[model samples]
Structures are given as C-alpha cells and as structure tokens.
Target: MIALPPELLPQLGEGLWHLFTVFLRVSAMVSLLPAFGERSIPTRVRFGIAVAFTMIVTPAVPALFAQPNLLAMVRLVLTEVLIGMALGLSLRLFVLALQTTGSIAAQATSLSQILGPAAADPVPAMGHLLTLAGLTVAVLLGLHVRVAQFLIHSYTFFPIGTAPLAQGLSQWGVQQIARSFGLAFALAMPFVIASLIYNLALGVINRAMPQLMVAFVGAPAITFAGLFLLFAGAPLILSVWSDALITFILNPLEPPR
Candidate 1:
C-alpha cells in the first residue's frame, strides 16, 4: 500500500472526522430502508452500503462540521442521525402499508394461512408475494437514486445540527400512520368486495338447493374465483401501491389532494 507523507495525515484525519458524522446519519437512514434494512443482510455489508451512501449524499449536503471540536462533533452526530432516521422512516411507512394491504387481501380471499410461519414476517403467501414484487419494482425503478435525492432535499427541511420540533414531528407522524392504513384499506377493498359477493351468492345457492352439498360445490368455486381475481388484479393492485409509494417518497412534504 502507498503511504501518504506525514504532513498529509492531519488533513486526512479532518476529512474523515466530517465523514464519520455524515456516516452516522446515512447509516441510520439506510437501516430503515426496505432492501437495505432487511435483517437477513449481514451487518458488515450494510455498513459498507452506509459508507457508500454517505459518499453519495455528502457532496450534495455539505458537512456542517467545518471546525468541530469533540462536543460540536458529538452534536452533529446526534442531529444528523435524528434527521436521517426521520427521512428513512417516512418511506418505511409505505412498505408497512404494502404489508398491511397484502395481509388484508389474503384474508379477504380466504388464502391467509398458507405457510404463514414460513415467512420472515409471518405473512400469508399472497401477502409475501405482493410485498416481494412491490419491493423488486421499487428497486428496478431506481430507489437508490431517489434516496440520494431525498437526502439532499432533507437538509432544507431539517437543517444541520438542529433539533426537530417535537409537537410538529408527532402530529406529522400521526398523519402518516393514518395515511398508511388508509392506503392499505384502499388497496384491499376490491378483494373485500369480491369476498362479500361470493359469500352472498353461496348463501343463496345453498338455500335454493338444500339437499345438495353446497359446501363441496361452493369451496372450489370461491377458491377458483379468488385465484382468478388475484391473477387478473395483482397487476393493478401492485401498480397502485407502487405508484403511491414512489409518489410519497419523492414528495414527502406535499399534502395529499
């Protein structure tokens, strides 16, 4: 390895000190991201990714630690981490919304218990499927690029080395949670309506043919209908979910119309 001259060491140390403060924020943010935050990923790999993301974000939002001593550096670390986590968590809510939608959809279609324990989050097969697909689509659509842009924009809302307003943050968080659940319900409404109709039809048919085995006939019919509905509607459901997620991530501060 090539060694730098002794005089350059102090300059290098200063740069690294600023970089480390930035690292605290970027790493916290990445820890909440969908793909980057998964528990299955190794800690070492995630740290490396945090380092890479720090590099991408640092140039855009210049470090505030220009002449930081120990106490100033500590404050920078705390403030940066808080801001990063706030930004990352806003996006993570959308992912949680997707999971909630999937679980509701699976339950509505009577497919909720297919190897539930096998999943990392213990979601049904359908829920797991949709979540995976949605995540893949997000990545392919360039989530990393969007994240870098988001980091740059965040500095405008949350300045360096400043504490966020507690009351304002709390209210915004409540609003976000409500919005997430509303989105989940909206996505699952179709399946829920289908289930209701299927049940009503089953009741009518059973009443009209009391002697016949309605359970035997209705089970397969409903199952087939559910499968067909999923096949036909999965694309639309995913499309709506993904679009909403991306839109919110790109425009976090925009009020929904």
Candidate 2:
C-alpha cells in the first residue's frame, strides 16, 4: 500500500467528517421512521438503510455539510438529531393517527380488545388491522424513496448546522398534534354516528318494551354494523391516511391542502 503525503490526511479527514455528519442526521431519522423505524426490524438493517440513504442524500446538499471545529461539530450534530427526530416524529404521528381512528371506531362499535395480540401495546383488533394495513400500503407506495426525498428537502426547514426556530417549531407542534387528533376523529366519524344511532334506537325500543334486555340485543347489532362498515370503508380510510402521510413527507411544514 502506498502512503499519501501527510498534508493530504487533513483533507481526507474533512471529507470523512462531512460524510459522518450527514450520516448522523440520516441515521437519526431512520431510527424513528414509521415502518423503517419499526421495532420488528433489526438495528443492523436500519443502520444499513441510513448509510445508504446518507450516500444518496449527501450529494444533493454538499455545501450544507462543511467542515467545522469541535464545538461547531457538536452543535451541528445536536441540531441534526433534533431535525431528524422532528421529521421522524411527524411521520410516526401519521401512523398513530390511524391507530387513534381505529381505537375510536372499535370502542364505538363495541369491538374493543377482541382478537388482537395483547403483547404488542394491547391495541384493539380493529386498531391492529388498520395500522397494519396503513403500514403495508405505505411500504408498497415506495416509502423508502419518499423518505430519502423528505430528508433531502428537510434542509429547507431545518438547515444544516443551524437549529430550528423554537417558536415556529412550537406552534407547528401544536398544529400537528391538533391536526392528528382531528383527522382521527374524522376517520372514525362514521362509526361514532352509527353507535349513536344504535344507542338511540335501543333506548326507544327499551322504553316501548320495558321487559326487553336492550343491552343484549344491541351488542350483536352494533358489532355487525361495525364489521360491515370496516369492510366497506377500509379502502377509503387507507387512501386518506396514505395521502396524508405522503403530503407530510413531501411538505411537512405546510398544512394539508
């Protein structure tokens, strides 16, 4: 092996340092990404994905990753981690939106805690189904490529070496949280309305026939209605969720159009 001149070593180190800095942001994002960041996947796989993504994204923003002193590097790393976590959390919240909707629907339809795996966060079966379906659809829609693009574009909002604006981020956080809950409620609205109607009709029937056991009569009817609604509306529900996630990835700072 031929040894390079001592002077070239500093340039090599600078290049490697730049790459490492980019890797920090990418790895941080991937570690908390939705399906990519799932607990089911191995850490090694996620690391590989982050490295591969860093390689792809570094070229797009070379000027952003300049060499810096130790103090600057520390600040930059911290900034990158925060930015990555923000991006990842944004996407993760999309999944949670579906979970919220499903839980609301299940509870409304009297189907909570039936047939879903108890070991994984104790979600209702309907919640598990919707979450799994949304994740699967996202993967099929080229989520990895979308993630790469998102990271590249994120510099627009959270530029390299610079921390995000705290006041703006705080407002954005509030908006995103409120929006998630609102979307969940919207998705579950049909079931809620159905539940209200079921209870109202049951009340009327029990009032007319005081001897009737309305709770027993209403349970099966509500459950069956919920199952049919799920069967009928799943495609629309998943499509809405997928569009929302993609919208956030493409333009996280903007509100949904």
Candidate 3:
C-alpha cells in the first residue's frame, strides 16, 4: 500500500479511527456470537475477523465519517461502534436464549454432567446441543446475509451521525431481551414438564415401596425418558426458535431522535 503524504496523515488517521469504531462494535458482537464468537476460538482469530468485517463495513458507511473535526469524528465513530454492537448483539441474544433453554433442559433431565465443548461460561450437554442447533439453523437460513441486509437497510433509515437513540427505543430493546427468557422457557417446557412428572412418579414409588431402590431405578427411567423427549421435541423446538430469530432480525432499526 502506498503511504499517504505527511499532511494527509491526519485525514488517514481519522478514517482509520472511524474504522476502529466499526471494529469495536463488530468485535463485541463476534465475542457474543454462537460459533464464531465462542471462547474456544483464539483471540487473535477474533481480532482478525473483526478487522476483516471492519474493512467490509467501513466503505458502506463512509458518509457517517465526513466530519473533519476530531471530537465530532470521535463521537461519530463511537456511535457507529455502538450501532454495530447493538445490531450484532441483538442477533446474538437469540442464540443465548437457545442456550438458556438447553441449560434448563440439561438440569431438568439429569444430563448436565455429560461433558462437551465449553461454549460460553460453562456449558452443559443440553447447552451444546442447543447451541449447535441454533448455529445450524442460523447458517442454513443465511443469517449472515440477512444481518448484512439489515445493516444496509439500517443506514437508509437511521444513517450515520444520527441523533442519539430515544428512551423508548432503549426501553423497547430491554423489553426484547427480557422476553427472550420466556421464549427460551417455552422451548424447554416439554422436557422440563416430562422430567417433573417422572420425578413425581419416582417419589410416589419410593413412598409406596420403601425397600425398593427407587433412586437407582428412577435414574435410568428419567434419563431414557428425557432422551426420548429430546429426540421427539428437537425438531419442533428448533422451528420455533428459528421463527423468533427471523422476527427479531426483521424488526426495524430505531433511529436516534
């Protein structure tokens, strides 16, 4: 790459700084993402991916960085980063919700002990399955393409250097995040309900036959039932989760007032 003259260095600096903001936002999203953002991936690789994303994104949003003043430029760049992070994280939150369902399922079905790749924080067996399913669906549905489309459309609506977001949008975002918990629970409810009934039956059996090793017998029974339910319900559960993901991605961007 040909180096710019010393006088133009300042302008170059500004552009690169703007790009760094994009990097920050994209990196934050990648950090939280399902497969690409997992802890198992090396930090260097993540940084590289962020740089590549920044390069791809910076050109599309150049109008946002036309301000020549340093402070204004800084503010614009920060805004870009925030917007990118918010967009990326909004998509990521669904994956987190799926993992939440998995965690609940694993605990309920006594399958938490099964070892698996540590996805985020500490992952359980169900967490792995959920993450895998979500990732698969995301990839299959071309989430990357849809996300890019959303980002592009966001510029048409919100534009760069737009005013700060309204309190209502922020509040709405918080509500969306809060709703994910309920969505996750709904996905995991079948397994949870099955486990509850199975455990209740075991308790009744123990009371009715004090001498029997209900605990030992109940273990296999619950495990088998849980596995069977998981196999039966995985398809429908994934469908619901995928629909939720699409709805979220299609929501309009909230421009700052």
Q: Could you give the candidate ranking by TM-score, starting with the highest?
A: 2, 1, 3
Which of candidates 2 and 3 is the stronger one according to TM-score?
2
lDDT string, candidate 2, 1-257, tens digits:
99999999988887777788778888988888988888888989989888999999987875633577789878888988988887788788887898899899999999996885642656788988899999999999999899989988987767778888999888888878888888899999999999999989999999999999999988889989999999999999999889888887777888643
On residues 57-84, what C-alpha lDDT tens digit does candidate 3 reach at each position?
6677654335457887677667766766
Give the better candidate number (1 or 2) by TM-score: 2
The TM-score that candidate 2 achieves is: 0.94
* Cα error, candidate 3, residue 153 (Å): 2.3
Positional deviation of residue 240's Cα in model 3 after best superposition, in angstroms: 1.7
- Model 1 clash count equals 0
Alpha-carbon deviation at 138 in model 3, angstroms? 1.1
TM-scores of the candidates in the order shown: 0.89, 0.94, 0.79
Clashes found in each candidate (C-alpha, N, C closer than 3 A):
0, 0, 0
Supply candidate 3's per-residue lDDT for 183.
Answer: 87
RMSD of each: 2.4, 1.7, 4.3
Give per-residue lDDT, candidate 2, residue 154: 87
Error of 2 at 85 (Å): 0.4
The Cα local distance difference test for each model comes to 0.80, 0.86, 0.74
